[model samples]
Structures are given as C-alpha cells and as structure tokens.
Target chain A: QQQVKQSPQSLIVQKGGIPIINCAYENTAFDYFPWYQQFPGKGPALLIAIRPDVSEKKEGRFTISFNKSAKQFSLHIMDSQPGDSATYFCAASRFNAGGTSYGKLTFGQGTILTVHP
Target chain B: EADIYQTPRYLVIGTGKKITLECSQTMGHDKMYWYQQDPGMELHLIHYSYGVNSTEKGDLSSESTVSRIRTEHFPLTLESARPSHTSQYLCASRGGNNEQFFGPGTRLTVL
Candidate 1:
C-alpha cells in the first residue's frame, strides 16, 4: 500500500560527481512534490519542490525533474561535495486552499547518499 | 530554519510507561503534523492538526494520540509505551504557502 516508491536505498559517489535519486508515485491526486534533505542528527529541510504544472525546478546546485503524466520525479545534485552526504526523501501531497484543510504528506522510502572527499 | 521545536531530543524509558513528546511552533502557523521515521528511513505521518481543537489521524495508523489545545503547541502521548514504538518522531508546521518546516525530532526508545 505504499503510495510513493523511491530507489537506491543507499548510494556512494566521489566528490564533484552528480548523484541522482528517483521516485515514482501511484496517486494522481498529488499536486505538490517536494524533496527533503536530512543530516545525521537534524530534522529534514526542504531542498526543492515542484508543482505538476512545471516539468523541472532548479535551486542552486540541486535540480528536480518532474513528470506529471508519468507521476515520476528525480533529484539531481550537480558537482556534489562531501557536505552533501545525507538522506533524501521525496514526498507528495494534495494541495488544499483557503487555509482550512491540513496538507498531509506521503513520503517515499528515503535514499541515503554519501559523497567521498 | 523553521521555528518548530521538539523537546526531549532523545528518550529511553521502560515499557508500559506513559510518556509525552512535546512539540511547539513559534511561526504562528495553523497546520501542524507529526511524523514517525525509522533510522535512515522514510517518514510516515501519524497525526496532524489544522488548528486549535482540530486533530486528525494521518495516513499511517499509530497507537499514539495527539492534542492540539493551542495553536502553537501540539503534544503526542503514548499511554503505554512498548519496545516496538521505538523510533524518531518529527514535528512540523505549515505556512500559508503549504511548505512544511520540521523540528529537530525526538528519538524515543522503549526498553
């Protein structure tokens, strides 16, 4: 009954290498897709997000490629550094407007990424 | 960083003990959520609140209970903790733009 599925439970890459993590969802009601990055001892922080309206979003060295029709998305880190080593999660939620409904998220199985210096 | 905070970053208690995990947000947001995650695993929603006095169960079924007595404070209580309940609990708040901000999380271990 998992709604969102992510691949590559763990990954290792050398410094300056690009690492990509992929995810797919089964629910079409999902309107917003977001990626979260978590350090070893900290809470997850929003790295990047995209709406179904767009095909891709780029923030700094992070890029999110989204395919609405396919219900798939992937995260790409360009020229990754050792500091980029962490766990990444992809989440989806249906958008509700007018500030009445709570937008609960459905998260994917996190991917642990390690960048060797 | 979000203004969300969770108290007792790490807790270890005996089984059958009643415990409460505290969560608070200073961002004045109306929506708050609680998520449970395993070590290096995905996050599963346990509960969420839209505003004061409005609480709802999330997609994942959980044995814990949550209360939203105030807009800024949401506390989760486990009446009888068990070893199976050991996991990391994350508290989050949502702003107008629907972006969620997570707290540092509480890692609980029931022995």
Candidate 2:
C-alpha cells in the first residue's frame, strides 16, 4: 500500500524555469512532510521539511506549498538549474516530539527531474 | 556533515553466499534504520533499531537480519544472497530533534 502518491514520474524543464512536483497522501495521521533529493550512486538527502501547522515553507529558491485540508503538497524549484537534475521524493511520517514515527518514513514513488542547460 | 557511513559502497556476490553490510555513525543517535530501494523506485524500510540490543522488522518484510550490539554500529547480514535481493541498501540515523541523516547507500548485486 502506497500511502503517498507522486505524479510526473519523469519531468524535463529548461534551465531557469520553474518545475513543480506534486504529491498526495492518504494517511491523516502523518504530521511531518519532507522532500529529499538523490543523485546517482548517492543516498537520499533531506532538502526541506514542513509541518502541518504552516501552509507554506520556503528555503532559498525551493518552496513547499502544503494544503492540510486536501492532504496534498508540492515542491517548487525556482530557477531550476542543471545541478538540480536529480530524483526527488516526498515522504510522510506520524512524527512527534516523542518520535511517534520511530524514524520510519513512508515514501512516495520518486520523480526524476531533468534540467536542460 | 552527516557522519553516517556504509562500507563496501558496491558489492557483487554469488547466490547462496553470505554477506554482511556494515553501518556506523558517530553522532550517537539512538535510532537507526535500513531501507531498500530499487532503481527509480520508492524506498521501503526493512529494519530498524531503537538502541543497543533492540532491533525490529520494518514495514517491509526482508530476509536480512540486523544486530545492534553497539550504539554506533548496526550491521545487516544476509545468510543466502539471491538475485532478487539485489538492490540499494541505505542506512540512516535520527538525531534528538527527529532529523534523520542518510549515508551513501550500498549497491548489492547477486548473480
């Protein structure tokens, strides 16, 4: 059972363009949402994370728009560059201060992003 | 920088052979997890440990076994490798604030 679903399994965009990746989750108990980036032969690294309390969060040119009511979230990369070409994944967890998730992350199908320079 | 490390970044073994994948962390995190990822696919948690002498199977069923005898060391072992077991194995540790850092995954290939 895939708790989280991501669309656009593969995306191609021009440099300096904005590319958006969308994800939808079914588990309402999920409190923490995070996006991770992975390069070839490397492990996934955390890019940004957002809590349900806020509707949006931004870091640098990356923004995460979260809609709690719809149980959907999207990642937007402004000024996409060739360096940003990698696999992206959206994950959710029943996170809490006490570690309700127990460090277990439920990941969605990954999206392979390509930035043409 | 994330201090988590996985040894034998790449491994190729014959079927029916025993292999061990090593993972170590210097951050002293109490929680550690292992995930299996196929090429261009989602990651699935295979195992995890909360602390020494405590290990648990994750949401995904796996034939690999894990042991956590030391806080910084968590190793996974496969008694008999199969072609189907070929995949990338990732190790991660969680800090006090729930920040999980992943190590470069080990790519295993069984023939």
Off by over 4 Å in 2: A97-100
- Deviation in Å, model 1, residue B4 alpha carbon: 0.8
**What is model 1's C-alpha RMSD?**
1.6
| Model 2 lDDT tens row, A3-117 | 8999889999999999999999998888889999999999899999999999999999999999999999999999999999999999988676345457578898999999999
lDDT of candidate 2 at residue A85, scale 0 to 100: 97
Clashing pairs counted in every model: 0, 0
> What level of docking quality does candidate 1 show?
high
Cα lDDT of model 2 overall?
A: 0.92
Clashing pairs in 2: none
- Candidate 1 CA-lDDT value: 0.92
Candidate 1 has a DockQ of 0.86
lDDT (CA) for every model shown?
Answer: 0.92, 0.92
